[model samples]
Target: MIDFHCHLDLYPDALKLLPIVSARNLFTLVVTTSPKAWLATSNVFAGYENIKVALGLHPEIAEQKAGERLLLLSCIPKAKYIGEIGIDGSPKYKETISLQESILNDTLTECERAGGKILSIHSRNASSRVLDLVEKNCRKSTVVLHWFSGSLTEAQRAQDLGCWFSVGPAMLRGANGRSIVASLPINKILPETDGPFTTNRSAPLMPWEAIDIVNTLVPIWGIPKEDVILQIRNNLAALISEENFQQNHSDTK
Candidate 1:
């Protein structure tokens, strides 16, 4: 199973779970909330082939940790994944909206220059603005909207821009989830656990719980479970593979 966005480092027993994540060889993207957090935990899972640690600067704290923006730019070359980044227009974070936009612009610019990067972004209540920045700066990067909560119009716009969306169990159970899922092209949809945040039976989920996400999509798409699993896996491969191709093309020139 592939978890495109998960705060693996935020789990209470993160250290204890590392070995299990590795043993299972689960395809997981471990996103950090800050550059310092990424610096601290990234190397811990370096030996695990299936775990990829992304460098992120979450928007909720973007304005306060402005210094980390430079740190994030400098650290970009060291990792292929970039995320937990983007705008949050929720009421509590409205004050830093401008700062978040600036950070996102810079992040997308860097990703463009790098040829390609996989980003798991958070849009919250600012899907249109987030999509604007993405369209303005992104050239070759693969953008995945994490737990998207936007209208169908904006979603269609995103799809036209080649953006992908990641959904967790909670989203699948949300009021607009069904319409959003139905609106999206099946191939562009990805499963994410967003573990420690999404729950099943009142228990915080693990990265591997992403399997449940795939299972959830099965009936939603009216396809066989195995086909859904295969499609999702292929989608992950295609996402990274396309970027690898772009990076290689840039390198050759």
Candidate 2:
């Protein structure tokens, strides 16, 4: 199974869970909330090719870590995946919206300069602004909006800009989320667990549990579960190939 966005390092028993995840052969993109976290997590999963660590500075804490911009930029050239990054406009974080935008802009700019990256973004209540920056700065990069909570129009706009969406069980449990997923193009959808933060019956969701998302999509897409699984696999393969092709083309240029 593929978990396009998960916080593997944030799990309380991360080390213990490593073997279980490895045994399941779950392809996971572990997105860190800070550059420091990314460095440590990347080292921890160095030899595990199935587990990729993305360098990120989450918008919710953008103000506090504004000084880490240079560190983020320095880490960009080495990071193939960039994410858990974007603007959050929820009431609690609304005050730092401008700062978050600035950080996101610089991050995207640096990623573009580094010849593009596969980004897992967080858009909370700022999807429009986040999409705006992505549209303005992205060229060779591939973007996936994680746990997206936006209107149909905004979702369509993002689709038009070539952005993919990552849906999780936590999101699927909600009526609004189901509505959003039903409206999106099936080929552009990817599954995520967003675990340690998102719970299932009060227990932290595991990366392997991302497969549960297939069952949820089954009813929404009016397709069989096996077909849903195959579609997700195909989507992941296509995304990976697209990123690889972009990287290769960039290298040639």
Candidate 3:
């Protein structure tokens, strides 16, 4: 299973058991909430092969602190994606929108230089601005919007730009998410469970729960489950593995 976005740094125990968990061959991309998490997250996945880091400042970090955040992010060479970064219209984060945009723009230069990187974006209430930024700043690198809670038209716009999307367990409970699962192109779809953040549990999510989310879209793909799994896994390899996407996929198979 491909876990598109998760905050593995927040759960220290997950790192220790990774070898055991990865032994079953699950591919997960652990995203950092901000520069503050860069070091700890990188340290956790230091030698692990199945896990990778997606680093970026979250909207909650005030604009005043963006410079400090960017400096910290720049120091982390291990980060492969700029993430969880975008505008939020939710009342709590409304004040953070400007700061989010600033960080995303500053991160774009670094993100673009590392060609073909997979970005895990957060477009909560600002999907439009996210789209605009993707067009202007992130078009050079590959993009994957996590838990995309956008309209079909917004999804189409992303598709038109060749951006990918990851559907989480929430698709099973909501119309918007389910609708996205039903219409998104199969090759561009990656599946995840957002895990501990979803229910605030810390035991860690097994790969099967992620598989269940992908299963909901099986009818939409009209292919055998295995085929869908394989394709998504291919996307996973391409997005998360550095310089060996094809080779990594071959070994996984």
Candidate 4:
């Protein structure tokens, strides 16, 4: 199984968590949201070979001394993806939005030269501008929007921009989440736990919790649960492959 977005660093018992997952052959794409977690996660996964990591400045921690942020990001040698990065929509988040964009731009440039590194963007209330910057500045590899919350028009724009969409456990409990999953092309979709970040107010997810989320919408997509899970994993490969997603541009005509 492939969990495309999870925070492995947040687990209190990180060492214990892996044995259970490895015995079952579950793999994860871990996203580190801060300089602290970024360092810890990279070391924890070092030599494991089964984990992939994304290092970036998340909106909540986006405002930082520029030198500090860049240095920490560059230190993660295992990092091939950039983000859980992008604008957030709260009054407090507004102050750091510019910092987020600045950090994101420089990271994208570095990723571009580093041979098309992938990204996992998080766009909350700023999907329109997220789409704008992605369309213009993404000379890097594929950019995936994890747990996307936007309109169909925005969704279409995202698809047009070569950004892949991911859905989470929230899809199981509500109309809005289910509707978003129903709207996406199965080929471009990926499944994630957003693990420690996507909890039930009680327990955060382990890797396998992703299974229950996939099972919930099995009938809607008209495929078997096992097949759907397989496709979601397959979609992860496709989305992360980078060769498949080509950035589209409109010329000044």
Candidate 5:
């Protein structure tokens, strides 16, 4: 199973769960909320080939952690995945929208300079602006919008910009999320848990539990669960292939 976006390190027993996740052979992308957390999380998961740590500065805390921008940039070359990064325009963070956009712009610019890293982004209520920055700076990067809650038009815009979407069980449970998933191109869809934050029955979801997303997509796509699983796996393979090619090209420069 592939969990394209998750906060693995934030789990209470993350250290203990690492071996379980490895044994399951789950390919998980663990996104950090701040650069300060990136190094420690990266080091913790360094021995696991299937687990990748994305350097990030979540928009919710972008203003509070604004001082970490340079640290984020300095770590770009070593990070092939950048994520949990984007603009959040919910009423709570609306006032800091400008600062969030600036930080996102800088992050994208640095990622472009580092030769296009795979990005797992958070749009929340700011999908349009997030797409704007992504398109303006990292057009060539592999961009995955996690738990996208935008309208079909915005989703189509993202698709037109070559962005991918990561859907999880919590998201699929909602009518709007289901509709959005149905509207998205099947090939561009990936499964994610966004776990430890998204819960099921009041308990935090785990990385391996992302497989549950297949059951949810079965009816939405009108195919059997197996086919849904195969499609998601294929999508992940294709994404990884592109990332590998980009990495190889960057190395040659």
Candidate 6:
């Protein structure tokens, strides 16, 4: 199974959890909320091929730490993945919309110049703006829109621009979620657990919780369970395969 968005550093037992995730035959993206956290978590999961630690500067905190935008740019060359780096247009963060856009623009420009970074983005209430920037600046990278909450028309626009969407437990429970999933092409769908933030019950979800997503998609897509699993796996491979990664890396040169 694959979890395209998981905050490994936020877990209570991150150290203990790493070993299990490392041992499992799973592909997971360990996204950080900030560049500082990325540095620490990258070191912790260093040399583990199965888990990719992404460099993220969450928009929720972008206003106060606008300085990190430069820091994020500097760290781009060393990173294969970029994420949790889009705008959060929720009421609380609305005031900092400009700052968020600036940071996101910087990030996309740097990634575009670098050529092949796989990005896992978050666009809470600012999907149109986020999609606009992505369409403008990112070309060689594979983008996975994590927990997209935009309208069907917006989703179709993103799809036309070649954006992939990642879903989790919360996305499966709501009617809007089901509609969004149904509207999207299955090939563009991926499973993720924005773990330790999104929950199934009282506790925050674990990375492995993405397994439930695969199981749940069976009936939703009307595909057999085995086929659903393969489709998801293949979708991930198509995005992060060695050939694609190498091509992106080569484009930078």
On the 0 to 100 scale, the lDDT of residue 158 in model 4 is 88
Better of 1 and 6 by lDDT: 6
lDDT of 3 at 235: 72
After the best TM-score superposition of candidate 4, give how far the Cα of residue 178 lies from its true spot, in angstroms.
1.8
In order of appearance, the predictions have TM-scores of 0.92, 0.93, 0.85, 0.85, 0.94, 0.93
**What is the overall TM-score of model 5 with all chains considered together?**
0.94
**Model 3 RMSD vs true structure:** 3.0
Candidate 1 lDDT by residue in tens digits, 183-215: 899888777878887788888887777767666
Residue pairs that clash (backbone atoms under 3 angstroms), model 4: none
Please give the range of 10 consecutive residues that has the lowest summed lDDT in model 4: 244-253
The lowest-lDDT stretch of 10 consecutive residues in candidate 6 is 244-253
Estimate every model's Cα lDDT from 0 to 1.
0.83, 0.87, 0.69, 0.70, 0.87, 0.84
Clash pairs (backbone) in predicted model 6: none
Residue-level lDDT tens digits of model 2 in 1-253: 7788899999998888776676563468899999998889888877766678899998989887888878998999999999889999999999999999998999999999999999999999999999999899999999999999999899889999999999999999999899999989999998899988999998998887888888888888999977887788778779887444223222111
Worst 10 residues of 2 by lDDT: 244-253
Quality of model 5 by C-alpha lDDT:
0.87
Question: What is the Cα-based lDDT of residue 84 in candidate 1?
Answer: 87
Separate clash counts for every candidate? 0, 0, 0, 0, 0, 0
